[model samples]
Target: MSAFSAIGDPEEAEEDEFTPGIEPQPTWCPGCGDFAVNNALKKAMANLGKNPDEVLLCTGIGCSGKLNSYFESYGFHTIHGRSLPVARAAKLANPGVEVVAAGGDGDGYGIGGNHFMHTARENHDMTYIVFNNEIFGLTKGQTSPTSPKGHKSKTQPSGSAKDPVRPLSLSLASGASYVARTAAVNPNQAAEIIAEAVEHDGFAHVDFLTQCPTWNKDARQYVPYTDVQDSEDYDFDVTNRQEAGEMMYEVESKLYEGEVLTGRFYKDDRPSYGQEKRSTGEMPEEPLAERYYDEDAEWERCAEQLIDKHT
Candidate 1:
């Protein structure tokens, strides 16, 4: 038999006057929290009335990377820990396109961690969703960057002695214009937060809490979370850096203690990298992608600029 195999064509889906859809056939396991992320993105796009063609979804290599396959959009499945650069390039080429990048905790917080920090620091105009399931789900339950201290995995059977990364705190400190945490259990909140991120003018990061029930059953306890915005008990201004930083410290501390504190922690109204470049004439107001529409445009002209850059 031929070794190369692909998913067969989906069955004929029921069609209404304006709606004809077959659900995505993802490979996620039963009870996997990834399903929630998929649903949330769909809801968010619908809520925003965004067309599939108007968006670009870049994903890194991991279970979460399969997001592009499920979401209907211009998609790029990039190498492990490399989706952010790809997303940034796409956005730079076409500032009009709504760009989003997704990857698992291991893909984003581990191998791609430097990209994560710099992308936020630059305040790129994009949304980055990190599926924080606390383990490397696609790689068979290995210890991930967010894996709690003393958490035992096949790779760390003796239990991890290293402290886990504080994603929200790191996001804030590294200059993410918006930072938030949401769990798979709260689909409504997830969709809302994602929508907000997409609408934001600068880099927006969401540390999405997912569960790898097949590999890490411990990840399943992310629910019973309280939204800091809706609760009177937690009165901290999200726009205040000091207040948000304090709140994030508290939230990160309690997560390992089995208390899932999920909510928006910080937000800042800052011009994105692209905006700054445009303001200073470092970048053209017209997107480079628009050049493709000019069939008569000389390709040699761009090559001349590249030569000029080198010489």
Candidate 2:
């Protein structure tokens, strides 16, 4: 039996099981959207029948990084933009653990953009949630990567001249097998999207619009969102890359224009990076964590192999 077998089984999971015995009250300001994210994630895990011990939540630096403090699970608060790489390593080492990486837009799209792109390109089996509040909340409301052009902040006092990063489009272009957008205002939709992302076999990116009411008072609260899947006004096949691309372009463009479009934008039935590596015999059938416990197990020293190659 595996050492990790003690992790609670899904059959015995309860909604309250995810809450820490001594729950820490979130320190986010009154009306902060971060609260909504915490609630939705817990609800989603419960709905999916996932035990806290079976999941790993990795968060990057920023207000969004505080998620690990409140969430009752295996958590890692990584440096800015470094959450994805850490999450990837954990997932590769223990394929049975459900890995979820999260961070703010600046921490993710700006600092960690390279990791994000490559992770998606590799189709790593994990869920990535980007809390896009348009401004740096914990850093005193600076202009973030997702901040709209002409949006003023302490860093961009003259107003931002650069166009905002298009998250959904970027995720699709970077080869994320599953992509979606949700907002804090719509907890039900957010929970549903998170659950779907968690269940997806390949890289899943969720652009979660969280309002920084204190920092970005001018930003939209993402209210009155139109669910593309349920609305007739927007008709595009999520499985069709071209159709999804076109739809994402429109969605990204209209976000700052007072129109909020939210829902699953893209999905592809593709083998994850780990799955492909295993098929190619590059990865062992047993998880690395399991193999490490065997005293007689022969391990390949990758560091030695690299040094030998260079010498």
Candidate 3:
């Protein structure tokens, strides 16, 4: 089979299928929201009938990065704020793989903000999950990009003066084809949103509101969330860019005000980077990874060529 073709045969998958054979007990603190993310992702993958071998999960540093250790999948625990780049390369080289990249608010929205914007603009076919817990959890309660204004932290003992980043708004403006917000407290919504994100053909961004009780105890637990799709108060077309933008703005504003709104905010039909490249004959129909396996295949070494030219 070609490397770009589907890697595994389809079959019914159980939730336990995604569990590591030698499961390393999760180190997340009791009542930590990270557990919900792991559970939702596993459930989503299983429900989609995806096998462990067919998926590639890349994670950045922080408590969220430990997802690679517990899930039974092709995993890459990347450096801080670098999961998206690595995940993008893997998906481009082997388009058949289901790629999902994850990181915490600080790792993704703060440190990796540039990568996040570009990846979305390029419309890579993958799901990017940002665990937005307001404060830095793994590094011991520092002020994070999502921390509300005037929220006191060890790093900001006097309370932070900077306004928190509007993640959903940024994602929509940066050109993510699919955008949604789900909380760790709402497992069913999270699982459903994840499944949809995975099925999307273009870049999918999920801003996951996770409560860091160990760190940001003052932050809301994300309870009393109203799912926009199920609520009569919210009525907007997810496919309409204008409507989605307006909705996202409201969601971002309400979050810091202690009102939690969660649900799919936007979706668009756009060709992914890989798809566009292939259609324009810039990329081979067969995956680049497949070429490396053929001993006789002719491959150009760009580094060697550049060195020879310079010398």
Candidate 4:
């Protein structure tokens, strides 16, 4: 059996399976959108019949970094803006594990923006969920890369001078095979998007809009949202790159205008990084960890074992 399949048993899976046995009460401010993200993630995993052991969640520093502590899974809490690289390594080492990386707007779009871009560009076989609160919530309210151009904060008291990064557009340009945006306020959509991202064979980028009610009271979550797929006004196809790009532009523009549009924007069937490597004969088809069980593994021997064998 594949290492991944050996870890999963969904036939009798329970929703509570993803909940930690020794769960600590969440300390996020009441009504904080981070709550929505946590809830939706668990709901999605449960619906997907994914056991905690079958999944690996990697997170970066910030309020979003606390995710692994709350969720029951094999998790890694990496430094600021480094979750993607760590997640990538874990996936490459164990091709059967389901990988997911998460972080806040600042941690993801700002500090770790380069990693995000390249990970999407390479079409890594994993899911990336970004909690976009538009500001740095953990370090107190501060201007962030996705903060509106004129939004004021501790760092930008006179309002930000630069334009906020358009995340969906950037993801599309960088080569994410699946791109979607969902909001914490709409838990159903968030869960659905996350589930879809997980099932996709290539890189899936979900820009999750999580409101920081205490830090950014005027945050985008203050408004009602419309799902593009459910809305009659939106008629573009999600599979078309040009249509998706245009739609994302409109959504980004509308977010600053007190309007919210959420849902899947783009999807493609391109090969993932692992698939490409394997096709090119650069990586093994089996999980790297499997070699440890075989003492006769000639090329994959441990350093000490190799030294002893040679000597």
Candidate 5:
């Protein structure tokens, strides 16, 4: 196997090769907000001062999963709700690489809720971007964790009886070191927020609200949610957990939401879990395949020893 298959081949990292190879443009609706979100991510990655191959974009299944195909980075399009586990593992195995997990609210908050919770507490260095369109677009209009109360959907025709999942508040409670919110239309703001998340040395989360015109036509009302100017206008109390809670509640209670707070909601530079396990300041100079899996039958001998011990 290639070195990249283990700890990732940093030498192969090339910003120019990071271009999306997809021939067909996205199949999302004309006014769908996914376009801007993708652009913002690409722009943020470009601004991060590293080769695209050094970044691993692991995404879960959904309309958002399609994003993996659009980026030139090492991409892992995994099963629904499992993006966090895969991302965490990838980051741990190759701590030198930047790992990003992308998914929808349903995939991240609903199905992958457990991993989401633990990863935050674990504080593995990675960025998770959740696309919250309120409804599941891939499933043809189903109520998701972020769907507003009483919202009608194919899965909840009688109007959703449950309360919408408050991702920002939940992420804060889950112990994520970096928490933020952004909208798709505000590409610059989104890119900036993502950049902040990338730079943070612990678990970073960004709740990206995008429009799903096909399934969630009503989300258009919040399309203007992307109008916030900069991180200054955002009352993102990156400290004080209480402030984050209050802001989340206030934003949810808005009648005609004016200044939608879209920026870093919380952040603290705690030593990441991976960093705690490291004894060396630098990674090994040799390839993991060569060092760990020797070609001179040493690999076989180690494998037999492990098997004997287990048996």
Candidate 6:
């Protein structure tokens, strides 16, 4: 056989309506919570009818970052705890494209917590979804920022000494325009939540309570947050930010207690980062390219400076 094999047709036949570059199977372990989370993301994109090229899926380091390789759209596997900043920048650079930031709880809450707070307050035009599995799934079951108090792990052999970080209350408090919570087990609800986030104009955030079978607690005992209201007298009106924050604090403060309040916790129509940016700048006449990279001499000078510093 020739070392360089040739294909019969240069172009792919029977083009799929969706992008087909994501052919390689995922590397996540079987029955991983990420499976449902990833599926929900795909369905959300499909529901939005967004072009693959116009959708940027940016992820931070950890198992969640590996999600970039599973998507056919424009994706960036960013450094640990830096996905928000990159996603924010991407949305600012191209307001038309749909930008999403994904990462594990440890990566988002532990290291990237500051970025998360600022992004929410700034109301960056992007959807940020954090996979909350409690423990650090990628680092062989180390205690994460959200790991329940008294929960024993590799790092916390005698149980976690610190309190578990609550994302729902924190996001709402930090001024995230659209805030919500969901569970990976309920794929349909999760998908719907993600779709709603994409439709929203301002900063939308959803912390998915994903179950790590190999690393953490029993998946069955965990109640997956869904939009469905319980038959047993539990009210969940997430329209008001104050009410949402209170409800979130009530449910999320205790470890695995209370009904999982899953729905649009908060939403607002305030001016987005994109709108503010548009108001500040005059519309370009000859396209952004003409203004930015019109001169070859300017590019050469910048490149020479970079080469001198690095080389």
* TM agreement with the true structure for every prediction: 0.90, 0.96, 0.95, 0.93, 0.83, 0.82
Which of 1 and 4 is the better model by TM-score? Answer: 4
lDDT of 1 by residue, 1-311 (tens): 11111112222321121121343577799988898888888778767766665678999998999888777777899999999999999999788888999999899988999999999999999999999999998879999999999999999999999999999999999999999999999989999999899989999999999988899976645878888888888989899999999999999999988888888888899899999999999888777776676677544467788999999
Runs off by more than 4 Å, candidate 1: 1-23, 296-311
TM-score (C-alpha, index-matched) for candidate 6: 0.82
Residues 71-96, candidate 3, lDDT per residue (tens digit)? 88999999999999999999998998
In order of TM-score, best first, we have: 2, 3, 4, 1, 5, 6
C-alpha RMSD by candidate, in order: 6.8, 1.7, 2.0, 3.3, 4.3, 7.5
lDDT of each: 0.86, 0.92, 0.93, 0.90, 0.76, 0.76
Q: Give a tens-digit lDDT track for model 2, residues 24-97.
A: 67889998889988988999998888888889999999999999888889999999999999999999998999
Q: Could you give the candidate ranking by lDDT, starting with the highest? A: 3, 2, 4, 1, 5, 6
Clashes of 3: 0
- The residue pairs found clashing in candidate 4 are none
Once fitted onto the true fold, the runs of candidate 5 whose alpha carbons sit more than 4 angstroms away are 1-17, 22-24, 226-236, 255-259, 279-311
Error of 4 at 305 (Å): 18
lDDT of 5 by residue, 95-165 (tens): 66788999998999999989999999888899999988888888889899888778888888898889777
Comparing 1 with 3 on TM-score, the higher-scoring candidate is 3
Residue 269 of model 4, lDDT score: 94
Instruction: List the lowest-lDDT window of 10 residues for candidate 1.
Output: 1-10
Rate residue 94 of model 2 by lDDT. Answer: 89
Q: After superposition, how far is residue 148 of candidate 1 from its true place, in Å?
A: 0.5
lDDT winner between 4 and 6, please give it.
Answer: 4
- The best candidate by TM-score is 2
- Alpha carbon lDDT at 21, candidate 1: 39
Predict model 6's lDDT versus the native: 0.76
Badly placed stretches (over 4 Å) of model 2 are 1-3, 6-9, 306-311
